[model samples]
Target: MSIKMMPYLILDGNGAEAVAFYVKALGAEVMALQTFGGMPQSPDQPVPDEAKDRVANAQLSIGGAEFMLSDNYPGMAYQLGDQVSVCIITNSKEDSEALFNALADEGTIHMAFQETFWSPGYGIVTDKFGVNFQISTEA
Candidate 1:
């Protein structure tokens, strides 16, 4: 199995606008876009009204380089300039889990590794060094 990584851009509720900007300026091709409202709803933690219009995730490509971004989840702190992260694409679910666990040691697990609508296993973590990573398993 092969692995790859890309840069991830985090936006403070301006993901849609940024996506438009990038498409216009960088000529990026949007691979997919999922808004918070587009996510499957749950009775326990329904999507907040404010988040419905915000971007949950968006994937794009500029030539061969793939990158992604999303609006900060509702009610979460959004610091200025904390906009970049890394996304690791792995072919195996086991590899994704191992990487998530390793990065989560002495670090923050923003989202637990689990199956999502987009991938078999996906998660987010901020390493001890404050570097955030989003691990995704290709379908």
Candidate 2:
């Protein structure tokens, strides 16, 4: 089987909320969303009610690429230094604007999506998860 590197973003503890944000901003289609508290495989694991809905794993598709997101596992200490970000590329003007507007809500919009010499409908933002995203539709 061929292996692929899917972008996995780790959020502090707001993964579910972050996923919702992405849905609006990127117009992403959610393929799967699971939480540690809801996983049958790990039923015995202790989970607080608050973390039950936190994203254990979420699969989303944008710009024809598969992307993944999750929250830090409880009790697993992490510091989350800035290292990488997943970029999304759109194919149409409508798709670009739809995604840009969606993502801009509840998050910081670094740049607004618009047509430019570099590309048509391109913008940048860092979702509430602190994961940077670049949205663009090719010229």
Best candidate, lDDT-wise? Answer: 1
The models' CA-based lDDT, in order, is 0.93, 0.73
TM-scores for all predictions: 0.91, 0.53
Model 1 per-residue lDDT tens digits across residues 48-139 = 89999999989999998899999999789889767999999899999999999999999999899999877999999999999989999998
Q: Lowest summed lDDT over 10 consecutive residues: which window, candidate 2?
A: 1-10
Model 2, stretches more than 4 Å misplaced?
41-44, 82-139
What RMSD, rounded to one decimal, does every model reach? 1.4, 14.5
Q: Residues 84-133, candidate 2, lDDT per residue (tens digit)?
A: 45656666778777776787778888678777554777786777767677
**Span of ten consecutive residues with least summed lDDT in model 1:** 73-82
